[model samples]
Target: MQTDAANPSLKKTLGAWHLWGIAVGLVISGEYFGWSYGWATAGTLGFFITTVIVALMYTSFIFSFTELTTAIPHAGGPFAYARRAFGPSGGFVAGAATLVEFVFAPPAIAMAIGAYLNVQFPELNPKTAAVGAYLLFMTLNILGVQLAATFELFVTVLAIFELLVFIGVVSPGFSLANFSAGGWAGSDTFGLPAFTGIIAAIPFAIWFFLAIEGAAMAAEEAKDPKRTIPVAYIAGILTLVVLAFGVMIFAGAAGDWTKLSNINDPLPQAMKFIVGENSGWLHMLVWIGLFGLIASFHGIIMGYSRQIYAQARAGYLPPSLAKINPSFRTPHRAIIAGGVVGIAAIYSDELITFGGQTLTANIVTMSVFGAIVMYIMSMASLFKLRRSEPALARPFKAPLYPLFPGLALAIAVLCLLTMVYFNPQVASLFLGFMLLGYAYFWLTHKQREAAPDDALLQTARSLVD
Candidate 1:
């Protein structure tokens, strides 16, 4: 509903390219490379089918988000949009869900980094690796958003190059026989009953395709929020979809899908086999690409911090989080808050285990649910905004109007249902968190209503003027 006055000095100097670069960097790094390895278990065809389904879901979600961002074009993506549609209470749920989604992202990335480090230094402690990566990114984020964005751009280019090289080297060695060696429909490795195995695999697929909405969070910071945000959103999704499919096809061709499934870091292992053990140069490049995954984590923090700041300014969160650094002209407090959560997640992952599972599983489980909820809220907000503010100017309208958003909403619901049906424990925990968010909103609604309206007016005027 409002951008904080404390953040009034924050400027929108980021051009469309910068925004697109950040979005692509984040999606590719976070969802594409960082998490796609898990899909290896399903083999190439399974991975391909899953990727296509997830990519469609991703693209549809972005379309819905684009429509919302175009209409609102504020600091918070869903949070701000939901506030405009259903008032402060709805905003709080949206904001909290988004905050949870982002707060979990950094640590998940850190865990991935730790996993990658194990490739280079098999003897190193994963806990230490996680902490080291967290501290590095925390400092980068604390320095300022621009610095983070610049670093992310460099890392993103390198990461892309690394992936391209990987594809190039591995393509020649790919064996189609390896792909179809194991039946595509079922596998003994999963251990679950046939139907259960397929259901169990949904989370891995969902995780691989998450974060397309990261672009929407950068909407307010874009040079031309209206034009840039929408184009970047769609373009970013398209880029990742292509890259994901390419990587899957290449991976299938390069080696036995059954063997690749067992290797956690499929790219490096595949490369080592394809290019031979002496290809030290290619190995180093893979490591560089891992750093790009680090960059993706950085980008997610940047986008999510801005969303948190926007939520705080709009009265859905503690006002202190809205504070901006004069020099950086960014939501310094919000960034720090997000970094703190990330750091905590690292600690929790190091110390906690449930049912023989590590904290990464918990975080991933919760994050998926939170992400899905935020997405649903966003789609619902689109319909609400259309009804509430029919005259609202939208620079970019989702093609087919209601059809796109409706499809996205349906797919999101399907994902949620599948997640719940497959893993009730995580689904329950995530739902409990959602209910808590709603309760927090209910308790804060009166206070929010009593807050002065002038701040909202001022914030809106600053943006339009």
Candidate 2:
């Protein structure tokens, strides 16, 4: 078995503050967009019901998940935890699910960024802007970790402030009348369709807290694993909970939630309810909202690169992916590899429409598909490790022990079933990717090196010198 030798190669530059920033940064865009899609299916009030339920699940899920992250403290995050509890196949599935969540997410955001830019310059082709975003951010990440993290902190703070501004500027105009006007678009009453819509709204609601677990993926680079992960995780989720409900309720009241429901730029559209569509305030928000997209887009890139680098170094992917840049000591190859894949996803979405879903919405559902699977696996890992590895040196134990994890698992299973029932096409795509990744792993598992995350990189370092 490999030890903690993965530490020597990666820099330890992140503290609890950075961890908090990262946790918020990765999911802040959710506060601005995506959640509105729930309005389309479940209407305003129904979506609120969905959000409340999902919020409780996340509260329980994150509390229990911190136990696994703190005890294991691996860059592979849930994958490492699942691997310890259930072995190689479990690790691959968890890792692939994470790959699905983190890797597929950026293209969806890149498209949003492109759409935001389109509002500013109508002539700028969205596809071109998205590709450009990938290139610009990938280069920044390849340059250095501290530089990337600092940028992440800056934009995340900016985006948070902007959300506060939006709430303040739009608050006075909020009306219950506006909120309820389109409260039940598709359903006649609280019947089967309404119930299914509530269940189907799970993915969009989960989008509010999706990838908040990504904070765990940064465990390898954090200052103090036991202290930082707990403080950051707790703070991070509380912060998002406030922001999520704030944005959802306020935005819903500010305008007809149905109008902004399926649009790519919900914040700007919601502003139309308070200020005229052509108001300078809406224009300003469109400008600032770009930062919200960048915060998530940039932060998730950091996450995916680290995940890929960690897994590849552990022999789960090609050795080339684990290689680090000698000058910057950053995972340049992994970052570029992720960027390329994201750009490819962008073009593929433009080319095909799956299950009558728009490229952006389908991609978002695909990410949620991975997120639900990861939640189930990670919750199970926590439950199993608690019973099996009693003396695992947990610095921050989950509050309710078995109850918390059990509830999270049950809720996750319910949500997963609901998501599959509603979006079979996206679910199939997600499952197909998992099967393909696992097949490759099954064939190559025997050839893997018996080393920790960075042993191969160490060999390369020695050869270079």
Candidate 3:
């Protein structure tokens, strides 16, 4: 009988640019917009320096992903790589971590959409707006991946155009005097409060560049995995980095750092300052950018569902989740399962705490912690693959090899440590989830052992050719 590895079901409809659109759609909006606003809170110099650090860290992450994706171009991305290197248990943990990121991100994006809409229509309630937007994206994702990718490409192009126009209009108002006023370490000008605030802001800064490897996760579905995956992964990161820096520069030029801190909608605020209050064109640009948030939520749901489906196929998750719909050829079961979990997450965040902290804050921090863990594991997988499968045909190898991977690992570890030390509540929650994953793995070990290894080994060896 022909093996499953010889006839996997996922069709390859994505090209290099389409894959690039997916990653850009996932990472470039939502939280990054919030991150840009957070920078204004710290002043221009502090924000600029911190953003550069975060961008470099993201570049390290991309390098690590590029190596692993090239070594093992499988449907599950990190989950598959971890299982092959360590075991089924490792794969489960990786999949769980990815689920954590995806489940929490949508509501946060919804919240941002709500906040932006509130800015435009001050009388509307933010929570109601957020839930409504979430429902719309959920419907879009259900239609299919092609629609999701197409929506993402449209949003990304519009976002880029809006950003360029914002920069062009705002740059002429440049004020070098405002550039170095506060300084990076938050000097005497802003006092000690500013210094600690910048340190506290690290996680939020890193969150902007969170999904840089999103394209690679969909590698198996791309038209030509070897060539397209690498191109999309690299190009997508470069595009986002450029856009981020442009926004920072323009915001710094149009208004003083203190003014930016008070404004949640920086792009609109900057545009208003440059063109004055009567400009309807600037308002339209801001509204277009807000729509990008909806596109982002749709892209994330698609990526997360695929990860869940891949893990289910490997027996790390229930087999029901592995079922693909014959008509759509999409992992319909997994998509429904992911949506249900996501809705639960959204409701859980509505609960409150005594200290003004909400469940949403806790979930966001846990997601960040989980992302850090996955990054370390994925980077280590690259190093392991270099030793175990040195003969594998890699169309694109990470530049600097051991050095780059080592640096990436070290930075990811630091971020993880910082997250734990800074917020023990979320850290504890992350540990608790990991423990639960371990217990589930223990229970499922027997099933994994009884399963055939022929399919798994064939999948691994295919990379060697």
Model 2 agreement with the true structure over 196-219: per-residue lDDT tens digits? 667778889998988989988888
Error in Å for residue 160 of model 1: 1.3
**What are the Cα lDDT values of the candidates?**
0.69, 0.84, 0.69
* RMSD of every prediction: 3.6, 4.4, 3.5
Clash numbers, per candidate = 3, 0, 0
User: How do the residues 1-465 of candidate 3 rate in per-residue lDDT, one tens digit apiece?
Assistant: 132553336656778777888888887664335665445435666667667766887886786688778667776777777777776666777767877776667666666677778877889886678778766776676566676677878887777777777778778787767656664534443455465446545566666676666566677667777788778888888888888777777676776655655334667777677788768757775688685676567777777778777777766777677676654556777777776766666566544221244444454565677677777778877877778778877778888877777887887787787668767666777788788877877898765665444334565787676
Model 3, residue 242: distance off in Å is 1.0
Instruction: List pairs with backbone clashes in candidate 1.
Output: 174-253, 174-254, 175-253
Worst 10 residues of 3 by lDDT: 350-359
lDDT of 2: 0.84
Task: Rank the models by lDDT, top first.
Answer: 2, 1, 3
lDDT of 1 by residue, 63-135 (tens): 7778777766766777877777787667777788887777776687777677778877889876688778766
Q: In model 1, where do residues sit more than 4 Å from their true spots?
A: 1-8, 31-43, 183-199, 259-264, 349-361, 446-465
> Pairs clashing in candidate 3?
none
Candidate 1's C-alpha lDDT? 0.69
- In model 2, what are the clashing residue pairs, if there are any? none
